[model samples]
Target: MRLTVRTNIAMRALMTCAVNPGKIVRKAEIAEATGASEAHLGVVINQLAQTGFIETIRGRNGGIRLRLPPEEISVGRVFRTFEANTPFAECFSARDNHCPIAPVCKLRNSLDTALEAFYASLDRVTLSDLTCNNAGLERLLSLEPVC
Candidate 1:
């Protein structure tokens, strides 16, 4: 299943915060490092904060940080947060479905099963699995800024 730009931005922001533990990492910092648009990042950041994935602080020292430990954060949960509202296919949308075979299509069930399997696989992985001990991710996402 294809993921959305919002999910991508959310993961990058989460990893940046995970790698930078105690620091209040700025959105510009995340955007610069991840090459994500600040405007899009702002929307993702707000959603992440609202869903309790990350916390945002206002002011000079303000920025963002993970509200829970990285190890406790589930990638699947994050994916679901950003992906659930979006229909997987044109036929998947209740209001927008225009498929003539909706009553006879068995493919939707198969697609749903496959999607759930994908999420289940990701559910086994935590943020720590993505960030911990990974020198490459640290170098790129560190608050210290890569040279």
Candidate 2:
């Protein structure tokens, strides 16, 4: 199953925060590092804050930081939050489904099972798992000098 652009942006934002640790990372910094637009990052940042993953502040000194520890933030949970209400296929949507074979589509179940398995694999991973001791990600995500 393909992941949404929003989810991709969200992960990039999370990784940006993870690499910085205690810093209140600016949206512009994240956008520059991840090559995502500030407009799109703004929307995703609000969603991440609302979902209790990151905490935000206002004013000139304001920015964002992870509310939970990096190890505690499950990638699966983040994917679910962003991907919620987004059906993988027509048969997956209850209200919007227009599939003619909706009554007995074996493929839908298979897809669902596969999707769950995908999430399960991601569940084993966390922000820390993605960032820790990873020279490449730290180099890319860190706004500070990575020695």
Candidate 3:
């Protein structure tokens, strides 16, 4: 299943905030660090903020910060919030009811199981799991100022 760019950027922004919990991070800095478009990230950031993943502030010291602790934030929760209402295929969507074989289709069940498994795996991991003390992330953050 392919994730939308919004989902991708939202996840990155969330992870970045998770790694630096309670620390304000500029949108431009997150965009630069994640290589996501600033314009696109703005929308995702707004969505995340609305969903209580992060809070935004205004002014010079204004930026974004996680609303909760990284250990308490699960990957599954992120996906559910950012990726909700999205489906792997047309058959998977509730709006797409034109399929004549919908009642007898085994593929839908199989896909549902696969999707559940995917979420289950994500549930096993938290934002802390993705925040490694690796050189790459350090290098990325080093190029920008941490708010």
- TM-scores of the models, in the given order? 0.96, 0.95, 0.87
Q: Summarize candidate 1's per-residue lDDT along 1-147 as a digit string, tens digits.
A: 679999999999999999999999999999999999999999999999999999999998899999999999999999999999999998789999999999899999998999899999989899999999999999888878456
lDDT of each: 0.94, 0.93, 0.82
Candidate 3 residue pairs in clash (backbone atoms < 3 Å): none
lDDT of 2 by residue, 38-117 (tens): 99899999999999999998899899999999999999999999998799998888899988888987998898999999
Measured by lDDT, the strongest candidate is 1
**lDDT, residue 22, model 3:** 53
Candidate 1 residue 34 C-alpha distance from true site, Å? 0.7
Candidate 2 versus truth, CA RMSD in Å, comes to 1.2
Q: Show model 2 residue runs off by greater than 4 Å.
A: 145-147
CA shift at 88, candidate 3, in angstroms? 1.8
Rank ordering of all candidates by TM-score, starting from the highest: 1, 2, 3
* Model 3 TM: 0.87
Clash pairs, candidate 1, are none
